[model samples]
Each structure stands twice: as structure tokens, then as C-alpha cells.
Target: MAADVDWDPYYGDRRTVLALVGLNLDAAAITARLTGCLLTDDELADGFAAWPGWADPFAGFFPLTDDINPA
Candidate 1:
């Protein structure tokens, strides 16, 4: 049996939360759990809106490279 860890205490620390998400250990689960805990619904909506191509899952399939030559 795994020990349950209460994540509420860590919610107030943005860096710790972000670092946890960045670890990608269980990103989807972590994101879902932290969704409304750190930010309000409106703030979350605004963040989603501000992220480019966030609405489209296929957006990252063909990543943009910075090596393009403009002639």
C-alpha cells in the first residue's frame, strides 16, 4: 500500500508546483490535481487562452525549428 501524501500544503509554492509538473513523473495526474488549487477558474482560463496552440493537441506534432533560413 502506498502512503498518501497531502498536496495541499505545496499548492502555495508556485516553484515547487511547477517543478513537480516539470518532472513529468505523472504530469496529467499532477496537472489535474493542481488545476483549481493554485489558480482560480478565470485565471486558469486566461492562462489556457494565452498559451499558443494549447487548444489543439496536434500543434506540437510538428514542432517549429529556429533553424529556418530566410532568403
Candidate 2:
């Protein structure tokens, strides 16, 4: 079972959220646009976790990256 979270309150600001979406784009073309921008590792990867879940609300599966190796 999953917890019901009031996520809207946490992301109330639209512009900031949009900017973050822009930052999360993985295209090579925008590499220069975000050049030198300071973002923590989590900031970079949070989109991956939040995206597919939101895009497919019923799906619980997510794609993991190589950086997170299992013990």
C-alpha cells in the first residue's frame, strides 16, 4: 500500500517547478543552458523518481540508474 501525500502544497510555486523540469531535461542540446548551475545529486535525480510515477499514476515500477548499486 502507498501513502496518500498532499504533494501540491509541497510544490505550490509554478515557476520554480517549471524551472526544475527544464533542469531535469537530459537532452544534450540544453547542456549549455544549465552550464555551471549548482544542483546536488538528488536534485538532478529526483525528477527520475517523481516523473514516471506522475506520468503513470497507477504504475509502481521505476527505472534505476547505475550509480545506485545494490549491496
Which one is best on lDDT? 1
Residue-level lDDT tens digits of model 1 in 1-71 = 12235334645433342564333267676567655345556656687556564455344544487765545
* Residue lDDT tens for model 2, 2-38: 2233335655432332343533566553454445343
Scored against the true structure, residue 57 in model 2 reaches a CA lDDT of: 28
- For every candidate, C-alpha RMSD to the true structure in Å: 11.8, 15.4
Model 1 regions lying over 4 Å from their true place = 1-17, 21-24, 39-71
Give the candidate number with the greatest TM-score: 1
Candidate 2 lDDT trough over 10 residues, lowest sum: 1-10
| Native-structure RMSD, model 1 | 11.8
**RMSD of model 2, in Å?**
15.4
Please give the distance, in angstroms, between residue 20's alpha carbon in candidate 1 and its true position after superposition.
Answer: 2.1
- Please give the range of 10 consecutive residues that has the lowest summed lDDT in model 1: 1-10
Q: Given candidate 1, what's the lDDT at residue 28?
A: 72
